[model samples]
Target chain A: MTPASSMNAALERQPPRLMLADPILTMTGIEKSFGDVRALRGVDVTVYPGEVLGIVGESGSGKSTLLRMMNLEDMPDRGEYHLALPGQEDLNLFTLDRFSRRMLRARHIGIVYQNPHLGLRMNNTSSGNVAERLLMAGERSFAVLRARAKESLDASEFPISRMDARPSELSGGMQQRVQLAKAIALEPALLLLDEPTTGLDVSVQALVLDTLKRLQRERRITMVIVSHDLGVIRTMADRVMVMRNGDVVEQGLADQIFQDPQHEYTQQLVHAKL
Target chain B: MKLDQLTKPWEAFSYGFLDQSAKREMRRRILKAIAIPGYQVPYASREVPIARGWGTGGLQVTLTLLKPSSVVKVIDQGADDSVNASSIRKFLRRVSSARETLDTMEADVIQSRHRIPEEKLREDQILVLQVPNPEPLRPVQPDMSEARIMHGDADYGQLWLTLYEQLVRSGRIMQGSSYPSMVNGRHVMTPSPIPRWDVPKMHMAANLTILSAGREKRIHAVPPYTRVEPLVFDDVPYRIEDHADKTCYRSGVTGFFMNELPQDDGSSSFEVSDSQYGVKHIRRQEGEPVTLGETYYREGRLER
Candidate 1:
């Protein structure tokens, strides 16, 4: 057999996306660099439909860089990104114009940032934050907006009494709840979380993590989460990808990676976690 | 008055009159604007006899369609004898032999500033509306090219966001004039500085409406039987000015748009905005027969 053909066969069997006929997102040969420094080098991200994929790495390891590219927020210098959503099958997101890309992101993809200030507008009421995306997607009915905002906030376990309260007026956990409520308000096909609970204290982080897990399960949403917290990756992710120095070192089922890590860096990470 | 984005600055004026070629050029642009409703068509705006921004856009249209047999009525802020309306009417008569009248039904062409005629216009009439700003995206996107691209792509999320922010801050939409409306379900056009009450009159109306901006050098049209819907949320319905309960003192007419005249002792009085309409009301009261076209509003609510 030709060497390149053999390698292609081997690579095809690697990600679980190939096992399933159609994946929600399939990215190949993604590369991004800043001047002389490479943030991501030849990264391939494959996310199956309705599966949770976790990316774990140390600081400056390009875990967040890879996650950002999934949402088209930070476009890779070169890559082919094909995504499938309901009614829109296999759209090449990388080649879309800015206007269409923005519309697609608004109507299809939902993103949650680590900082509540970045994710939720601090001045707007909690319900306003949740309703902003719906409004942008052309939902004009105030009664429907109110009901849907209440439904999302209630689903996220946010207090119904504080629906009109602003994000700055709430605690960190409650603010994260609002962020979660807004991200899922549209019921987007894909959700990307970047260090969702990193800024909170340990107790608040646990509360926020619990809320995130419940929402993810109930919605059955396909997700790609980037976190340095191994416990989060262990409890939440179905599969895990390990990265170091702008390259993915190891990836497999979450249980296998935690119990018997294949790479030395992954073994160090698994062993270092208490 | 804002010169920061003048793409084609005014180079010269030709005695404030349009030649036959200029009129033909305007006809082409008007036809294009009508063909693609609500899309702004750029044109060479000639400096008319009046000062800039003083209904020169509407005056250009009036001059273009001027004929000795044409009967023209000019109204500003719903008043026939207002300074702006009177000057434009005298100018039209002086330039051409066209007759001037304050009666809405007698006029073949009506050139207006701000408000449409209170009397429902007929299919035979054409309404020339003077526009100060043609770009509805000006508030959200300041760059002309960027605004053009937004219009081309029909990306109006920022406009909705602005309205949402305003609603969150205030109790209602504070946009009182030039209500941005969706024309032909495709392009969002500013219905020229008209009040919210007058916007619904253009939707599926029999009369043709042409909006033009001189200083901005842009023109758009809403041909007969087109949809002109104000941008509003379904649950948060569009509310017009609250003038239903008020009555006009001069003509004893109630349930029409009124202007609140303040008194010296912290009081107010109501006057009918449509001055000629009020005159007709007084003439009828005096037993002089005057035909009043069916008003667009009855009991201060638009029938359509």
Candidate 2:
């Protein structure tokens, strides 16, 4: 069987979300515009715990913009973005003061970008890239930092020998692995990936995706992944949301959405993949 | 030039070389600087006989604090006899009529250019450091107003990124002097031009340290018993100079910051950077009635 067929088989065998808590994220009526162009128009999303929610769309579909909003990288023009984690204070992402927003982002959220350069500090060593967030979170002891960085790098299946190697010196796939290592270093509660494997070679993409899948399973982190690749969304995400022209066209379980897509855009996307 | 002509004129200048109003303004600004810990308070930097960039910042503060009975010691790059240090010392004494001493332990106020005195400063003492550049963010940011905003926002990511880049490029941090440190958990400060060896001495130190830049017209303080942490990565530890293992050739002081002197054979001999401290050690070894205060570093290691 081809890798695509194998991915479908794995998708069929995947388990359902393990728990049903209060939605970790509650965003409604989210709207964003740049000058005359509306990047998002009344987007609403509710994410439960321990579920991989994949956002798939064509270019300029506001997929990346929505992921950015989810991670608080950008503020929607009009929306109520609340984070209601277990036993934690409900954080209004838009209304928080700068310091509190920073603390919330640092402690709970992790983001991996489409390009590794945007995520990893190119000049910093692989371990330093992983430990940078830890340092910013007020971690001081070298021993503790090295041990924790080692654990994350090991989980990402990165070679321990390259711990001191800078990201600029690494290959594209290795750079992406370093980005993954850095993002998951603190074992964050929420992981947001924006076209994380889009820029890598096909073979390299497989390795990175495999590493990401293993990480998501081992950590059971709530994830919001944005990609145009249906195979990626199919093999990984439990639930899928398809977007077109700054709106979520359809959202449902991964199997139902792919097997019997309702929206024209989503059907065209699925058929194009075949 | 007749002696009688020169003797005809008698001038009355303000005490401590600064006018009453200037001193009062400085006093108010100093208090604010101390209260805010690492926040730089701008002041009207006045002119003095010394040049603007050369220990003038330290001189202004020393002049403001001096009284008839206040004992003062001054050092430049750890030397008590340097031209800048001695001139500032003499100028301070001449104007305020304060007592002058080279010994660090005997001073009420210690004005220094580049190094912290080797001896531990007491609670009664105040250290006035001459800061050439008060802004630690200046390396990453050149715009003063924007730098101020970053300071207000407690945004030090660029400064930390510089260190991170240095670690990767050089295999070690290349900041030889003027180490960037976080003061009291809020402000990232450049602790004057003191070596990395002396940066740790300011952490929760007993004495109050005021860093003033005359050219820049900014003064910031590290109040007594405040945290002064050097900006460092956790995995890449902060390392001091390798001078700990070398002994001073002149004073036989083994565990202090040192100056290297090139010899005829191309070998370098070490001497204690704190000139007066070394003299006291030599005097004590020669059976003179001398008292040596406890040093910040002992046996080539910093005492916690």
lDDT of 2: 0.85
lDDT per residue for candidate 2 within A1-274, as digits (tens), equals 1011221111222334543456677777778999899888777777777889899999999999988888787888897888776577775689887676777787788998988878887866888888778776767656676788888888888898888898899988888778888888877778898888887889989998898888888778888999999999998888887777777777778898899887787789999998
Candidate 2 per-residue lDDT, tens place, B20-109, comes to 999999999999999999999999999989788998888999999999999999999999999888888889899999999999999999
Q: Pick the candidate with the highest lDDT.
A: 2
Tell me the TM-score that candidate 2 gets on chain A alone.
Answer: 0.91
For chain B alone, what TM-score does every candidate structure achieve against the true structure?
0.94, 0.96
Model 2, docking class: incorrect
Per-prediction DockQ comes to: 0.50, 0.22
Collision pairs in model 1: none
Q: In order, what fnat does every candidate score?
A: 0.57, 0.39
Across B131-190, the per-residue lDDT of candidate 1 in tens digits comes to 999999998779999999889888776667566666766868899988889999999999
Relative to the true structure, candidate 2 has a C-alpha RMSD (angstroms) of 7.2
Q: Which candidate's DockQ is highest?
A: 1
Tell me the interface RMSD of every candidate, in Å: 2.4, 3.9
Quote model 1's TM-score. 0.82
TM-score of chain A for the candidates in order shown: 0.92, 0.91
